[model samples]
Target: MQNSIFKTAEVTDYIVQWLKDYALTSGVKGYVIGISGGIDSAVTSVLCAQTGLPVLCVEMPIHQAPSHVSRAKEHIAFLQNKFSNVQAVEADLTPAFETFKNAVPPSDNENLLNLTLANTRARLRMTALYYFAGLHQSLVAGTGNKIEDFGVGFFTKYGDGGVDVSPIADLMKSEVKAIGKYLQIPTSIIQAKPTDGLFGDDRSDEDQLGANYDELEEAMLAFENGIQATNLTGRKREVFDIFCRLNRINQHKINPIPVCKIPKELK
Candidate 1:
């Protein structure tokens, strides 16, 4: 399945309008976004700013790498300079993370402990975003794209996934880049490798997923179109398997929360 072509200008306009409509209907003043110095967050913040409403760009760094921190600051500065309604704040989460680390019991499984800590960072950021949202009467706008949110479920549940509105959830990573370029997002950010910044390392999303966004996108599209993997071979087959495995394992994140239904007779 081929990726859909979209005009950046038209799509941008549509998203900005949709944001405005949602905010107006929900009675919120604006949006609060946690900028991660990645392409998705930068694009989402810009889209939110384009709505001509108050946009709070929060930088929540939990022992974040220098490069990620710099890129996030650069994006926030760019947004503030370009959009009058854009505001910026930094919630240094390193200390909070350390405190939480001391509180949790030690685990013999280092890998599990590291993964759990990484997810805890994301959830901490989510908490910070909501704090600002509640203080400012704004909605927490999500930065997830199509591949991450639906294809592979590559987000922390109740963390980055816990958002009031998703402005770019439907757009693919490539599509988000196109929109980012159209919006003239900082060149440094536009070219930077995608990373979740949860592990406080230079490792990228590709490093974690074992497949790049483009590869993942292709596999996702193919799977959605019911393309049989039996005919695939080599790298394509590997990527398809990775996508399938992630999609299967992360269904709990992608789908609505399960609710046990009571039988009518029980009432």
Candidate 2:
């Protein structure tokens, strides 16, 4: 297979310029992003900072792991030192999550309950971002990559997927990492395992998706380009099957929400 690698500096410059143009034309004051200490968020925040516009990096922890918070702080500090426009804030959502979760109807299905609560965590973070965005007239920057956003629909609708602009949404996971390295984001964050941070546990993106990002990205690239999953063999076939199943099941997320169209005659 041909190399899937991207030109680090070129991609970084493109995204940086994209952010600059977006803020200029959109008339937003600045950028607001949830810095989850994951590679995608770290890279997105750095790109926003590079635009020389005021960027607020909010660490909205909801029963967050110590390591995740630590990495987030580290990245925040790193960017603040490098860019005058970059600032960090903490919005602890643990109390909100607790209040919200307590009100949910009790369920015998632990899995269903956990999933609902996890999605709640994401929505709360989204709410916090918008709260500040409205206050500062800024836009919420999204961090989902192509694989998660378009392939598996790994993001919670109107939660992590909620944003004003997604600078890296077109890029794959591998491409995001490449840009992360080029931007000199903290090595610890770039190398850290990816997570949604909504589960309140240390479960990773791979664990939830049932496939590693590299495998999923490759399979998805093929699938989107009209390559059939049935054409693969051996381990490739396994990965393709996982990708296909996820794409089929989560297709709703990437598709337009169904709306009833009334007939003109009836009207």
Residue-wise lDDT of candidate 1 within 199-242, one digit each (tens)?
98999999999999999989998899999889799999999999
Worst 10 residues of 2 by lDDT: 1-10
* Steric clash count of candidate 2: 0
- Scanning candidate 1 in windows of ten residues, the lowest lDDT window is 1-10
Identify the candidate with maximal TM-score: 1
User: lDDT per model, in order?
Assistant: 0.93, 0.89
Model 2, residue pairs in steric clash:
none
Give candidate 2's whole-model lDDT.
Answer: 0.89
lDDT (tens digit, per residue) of candidate 2 on 1-267: 214555778878888998999899999878999999899999999899989999999999999999898999999999999999988889989998889878877889999988988888898999999999999899999999988888888999989988999899998888888888788988999889898888777899889888889989889878878887668898778989998898889888878788999999999
Off by over 4 Å in 1: 1-4
- In lDDT terms, how accurate is model 1? 0.93
TM for every model, in the order presented, reads: 0.98, 0.96
